[model samples]
Target: MNKFLEQALLFDFYGELLTDHQKEIYEQFALEDLSLSEIAEMKGISRQGVHDLVKRCQKTLEGYEMKLHLVEKFLSVKEKVSKIDDTLAEWECEKNDPEEMVKRIRKIADAIIEEL
Candidate 1:
């Protein structure tokens, strides 16, 4: 994944666990695309301080993902759903046998249930 996108995903999944200050700085730097110097000046902190806070927030968010795997599970489930959609579209276009399509859908559904 793109670095910014990964950061955004981690933040989306675990940002609530961060402190208010951390959230503000992270939102400015990562989400709002502010420069470190700009964030520093706005927050009345040194540029280095702003940078460190953003890095700390990143580490904290990644740690949460490592332990809980909520983001991982969400992505997996989303992919499975997309595959199911693709199968349905293919069935519609090709007019494949209904019994085979049912079996395929059941298999995917079973895997999703197992994961949950």
Candidate 2:
């Protein structure tokens, strides 16, 4: 996965676990895509301070991902579901053995939903 997407998933998975201050800064910097300087100007902090806050928040989020693997599991299931959808779409137009493909896709989709 792309770095930004990975960070975003991790952030969403872990942001709620952060302190209020940490959540504020993280939401601005990661979720809202604010520049460090921009956030610092709004928060009355130095750019370096804002940078450090973001870095700390990143580390915290990554720690959660490392220990819990919630984001990783969610992403894996999502990918599986997408692949299943693709297979189902292909099976719709397939000329031979479409039932097996459809069954496989249904099973994957069911498993993904169960995980969710």
Candidate 3:
């Protein structure tokens, strides 16, 4: 995944755990695409301070992910659902293989259950 996208996902899953001040700075730098200098100017802090805060927020979010794994589980479940959708779409076009479709779907569903 892209670094930016990875950061965004981490923030999405664990951002609520952050303090209000950290959330505001992180949202500006990570989600709002603000530069460190810009965020520093807006918050009346030094550019390096904004930089440090953003780094700290990323580390904090990563720590939460390491402990909780919510983001990992969510992505796994989402992938499984997508596979099920694709199988159904394929089955719709290849109507001759109902048995195969059922087998594939059941296997995917079982994996999803295991994940949960």
Error of 3 at 63 (Å): 0.7
Give, for candidate 1, the lowest lDDT window spanning 10 residues.
1-10
Instruction: Give the whole-model CA lDDT for all candidates, comma-separated.
Output: 0.93, 0.86, 0.93
Candidate 1 regions exceeding 4 Å error are none
- Which residue segments of model 2 deviate by more than 4 Å? 106-116
Question: Predictions ranked by TM-score, top down?
Answer: 3, 1, 2
In terms of TM-score, the best-performing candidate is 3
Best by lDDT: 3
How do the predictions measure up, each by TM-score?
A: 0.93, 0.85, 0.95
Q: Per-residue lDDT for 12-88 in model 1, tens only?
A: 98999999999989988888999999999999999999989998999899999999999899899989999999999
Which pairs clash inside model 3? none
Q: In model 2, what lDDT does residue 20 have?
A: 96
lDDT of 1 at 79: 97
Error of 2 at 23 (Å): 1.0
Q: What is the model-wide C-alpha lDDT for candidate 3?
A: 0.93
Would you give me the overall lDDT of model 1?
0.93
Per-residue lDDT of 49-112 in model 3, one digit per residue for the tens? 9999999999999999999999889999999999999999998887877999999999999999
